[model samples]
Target: MPQSLFSRMVLILLGGLILVQSISVVFHLRERDRLLFRSNSMESAQRIADTLRLLNSLPPADRHKFVAALNSPTLRISLVTPPSSQPRQSPDGANQAASFGMMLRDLLGENPPIAVTVSEMEWPARQHEVNAPYRAESIHPRQKTAFTVETHLQDGTTVSLDALPTGQAFPLPPRLLLNLLILLAAVIVLSLLAVRLATRPLNTLASAAEKLGNDINSPPLLETGPTEVRRAAHAFNTMQSRLASYIQERTRILAAMSHDLKTPITRLRLRAELLEDDELRVKFAKDLEEMESMVAATLDFMRGVDNPEPLQPMDIMALLESLQADAAEIGHEVRLQGIAAQPYPCKPTALKRCLSNLIDNAIKYGKSATVIVNDDDKQLQIHILDHGQGIPEAELERVFEPFYRLENSRSRDTGGTGLGLGIARNIAQMHGGELVLKNKAGGGLEVILTLPKPITSGSMATKTGAASNIQAKKPRM
Candidate 1:
């Protein structure tokens, strides 16, 4: 249930590896147990057969003396009276006894009837209870397994053999567990590295897409890596190239149309001047001016669609001061406050134009403009406030559309072509920033231009400067 592809892949690979290792270990243990059982059975049969041969070769009284030498921890040999009936055994015990009997007969070379029975024996039990020669006290109490073999010798004497398998195949040693852990750790580390490598291309593609949104002219993705990655990068680069071409072509066409329309407007203005009636001439000139203005504004909007200006670091406070000075020269009231701690990366010409439009709108509508700058490592925010009746909530966003003005009178004196906010927002988005408008609490409009700081911006403390309200006053005549 990992959210990331890397974590999911690692989980699946590790889970599969752990599962396979478990199965492999199980099969390995089972096979080892099987081989060990065969080896132990053969060894036990040979030992019992050799003991019988020795007993047959020796005198009857001496056979008892050899019994002590034949006895061992895993195997014990003794003489006993023949049982009156066959021994009872469980299903699994019966299978084991039958297989062992076959092996014993093969070793002995005689087809004598061998009564073999496997039984579960608890620790500290009396050896006489199951008729085993002796208990295997060296084995752990948990094992609790014993086998009894009774067969007749050449002299009609019955010999009893007890065997306790070593059970070496089941228990896992500490060293082996440590080795398995080490191997698992190594495999997990390698899997993480491989998954990261495989998913790295996706990260690159996403970054490229974000950069593309900010600047169409941003560098293309490098067509390197696996075949699929290369193909994707190539496609993205192709799309970017096509989009850039389309924007350039549209700008060119708009510029040409603006030039062509201005020629007829100029001719018409000259013809209007020659009219005999002054009132009619004034009306014609005004109409011609409005048409020329609309054409110029349309072209400007088209140009703003894509500005190829390269980004560079600029002092934002200096730009604000210059704008304030320009407004003062025009007899417009402008106030400035706050300081930028560091230079911000932006298109200097485009940014200056964006700020100029907002400040001009504030002065024209609100009679005065107050610019407050809030700068930090993360982003630079410039808030332009005005002291006019705030716009209605419904018309706030509608005013951003090109040529859509709130002044239904359509008088140039009341509101210039409504493309200022649109062009300004376009420039902000080009720099990967945002511009938003809000109604101030104190009966005014507030426009906030938020520009994000680059990752490498320096860490510096920004201090608020004393507010300087500049007003242009006409000199005394």
Candidate 2:
């Protein structure tokens, strides 16, 4: 199916807006997560620091009890005392004490001036790096001094022992997802509304354009909408008005010219009647007759060009039969072919003039004329066939130009002014129809005139009148 410009525009706009909003939502979530993570990390670090200070003031036995009571895999406590006189030794000897002293010395070098050691500890569920140490100070508030502990996670985050429990480090905010969803919905709805509002005027402009070709006299379009839309509509309306006025002016000029030429042509014919020589008088009269015919055909052609008659229903078969009988009466062989069954909506006078010209041309040039009326549910086609010297492919289109006769040889005997086909085409177009000329399969030329079907009650009435007239005239009777 074909898509309208307005719908396509809205679709493109909405799609782009959705894409941009989606990217924004992603970035917003990332930024929010970063902020929440930092906040949680700081709070955990502060709690851990406070816990370590409390642990350092307790005696060794009480400190062990406190550590056991706190029992968290993420936290550990240790006590270290310096040797009194000789080097202290256990079953493992100097190596163990030397290792422990070196680790504690490294911890004291870290910031906050507290001794702490970290060792990799492996367990069944997870692995951790834990460290803790104590120091004695004279100015300390407690009996001895203070100890500090630190833990590190695999993800590159470090927590001080004085920090709070990592178990409650950060919890996801409950309303965050709901708020994001609301924002997303609002954005989509607002975008769609904006698109609709912006494209409404464009739709109106398209509709107006479609109608313009068929009805040039339609009222000016409503120039409302965005600034650009209003400007475009105003320009279009101005162009339509100018085109209509130009056509009207041209028609008036042609009518005036035709009226003015008739007086001189008539006077010349009257003057030729008094000529003394018989041969000369006959030739002059013949010339005058030819000139008069050309003048009349030219006037008809010009009138059709500008003032198109209104549409009415016409009997397709009847119109053809009338032309056929008229040709037969003139001693020309003419036949009616196909169905004369249906009536179509068209301009009656314009359509009749168009078909009459076609038949006249056929009879004049081909010496015989045949008309066929073909009808379908949707439209009607009228074909006028003539057995004559068909037009050359090159001259077919040129034949429809005003005053453009075929070649000198063909025009000599026929006395054609070359306006027949041009006038036929003009009449056909006035009725929203077209005239097409083509070479027949066997010989001669076929002229096809196509007209639209009627759709209203008033059209049906007009069609009935034309149909009755066609049926009343019987060739046999």
Candidate 3:
């Protein structure tokens, strides 16, 4: 489901590790409980055996004293007449007493007569009867398991043992939780490092691709990393080389054509100069000049889009205001509404040229233009708004095509070689940006020139590091 390869890999690895750890923890805890239960059961039986041996060795007169000394909260020991060998089952059906009876017979040798019975601590039927020679106390009422053991000795004496030893409850292992946390931390750190390493080449490809859009001559990809990544890089590098070659070849052809056409254009201008008729001669010169200007503009646009100037930090606010001031001098109404928060790395000359063209269009078609600069986390936006009739919706996209414009703005009267908006759009796209036009809400046209932020080595830049004249938003009237 994840779009990123790195995220997918991390999810698979972390999910499997957590599941395996969960199963192992569950299994180990259960095994630990079982072992604890078995060991506690063995110890309870041994206690009864050890006390029986000590009691049998003492005389009848000292038996009660020894029994009293051996009695405990869990294990109640005393002497009494041997209970019948008849079976008395417990309420919970726990056969611990039966199991221990067999153990006692083996531990005390075959000659000893031993019998055992287990019952719930709250045995409703009856309690064990102790002989007058016995000195014993009742088992703790809280005790859950009430077991009684009877045995006959060689001297014809009998003794009884009541044990209610509970198995140890499962312990909460803070140590285990601590261990899991440490392991999880180590895994996360390792996963992050591994993901970064795996995704590094893809990141390189992405950066190279982005730069390729701005500069067709972006440097070749590194072609390093895993086998798959290396193959992808190789293909990418090959593609970049082919594209740059193709664009370069096309540019070369256009330049040569423009060069060849210049000679004829100059010859015609010279011939027009020698003509005698004033009206005819002047028209010939005008036609020749217009032809030369169109050729020059076309070639200039080709060069601007494919071969952009080098990037440098520029005060875009000052640049816009300068344009506004220049237009005002020519009696064209241009207003600088807002300014950028910082200077950014850009081809200032190309951008200025692009802005000039857009502002010219806005003023010529829309009567007046206002330039507003706004920037956010990712890109810079410059809006050129005009107060005249907006372009028709159907022709908004067509207006950007070279030599193609709206019927209103494309007339010879407008005096463009039909390359102004096309050239401006190309310049913007060459900087990894877009120039989009839309009709404004209040009855005018708005052209938005969106420029991408400069990509830095470690990360994409969000703020300008160098100081410029404009640090805060201020409008210069």
Which residue window of length 10 is worst by lDDT in model 2?
137-146
Give the poorly placed runs of model 3, Cα more than 4 Å off: 1-3, 47-163, 268-293, 325-330, 340-343, 375-380, 408-418, 452-477
lDDT assessment of candidate 3: 0.74
Clashing pairs in 1: none
Q: Give a tens-digit lDDT track for model 2, residues 1-477.
A: 228655676677667877887898799877765565445444344545555555655654576677656544344433433323432244433433243334433433443433233222332122323333232221123121112344432232233342222433355567876886787788778867877888777777776775565456667988877789889999999998998888778777866877888889789988899899989999999887887777677677766665556656566667776777777777888888899455566666656677777888887778888888787765678888889888888988999987887774358466777777887787666655678999998989999988655456334644366443633321110
Instruction: Give model 2's TM-score versus the native structure.
Output: 0.65
Worst 10-residue stretch by lDDT in candidate 3?
Answer: 468-477
Per-model CA lDDT versus the true structure: 0.78, 0.63, 0.74
Instruction: Tell me the RMSD of model 1 versus the true structure.
Output: 6.7
Best by TM-score: 1
Clashes of each: 0, 10, 0
Tens-digit lDDT track of model 3 for 144-193: 65667777655877777777645566677899889989988898788878
Q: What is the TM-score of each candidate against the true structure?
A: 0.74, 0.65, 0.71
lDDT of 2 at 419: 79
- Which 10-residue window of candidate 1 scores lowest in summed lDDT? 468-477
Q: Local error of candidate 3 at 220, Å?
A: 2.8
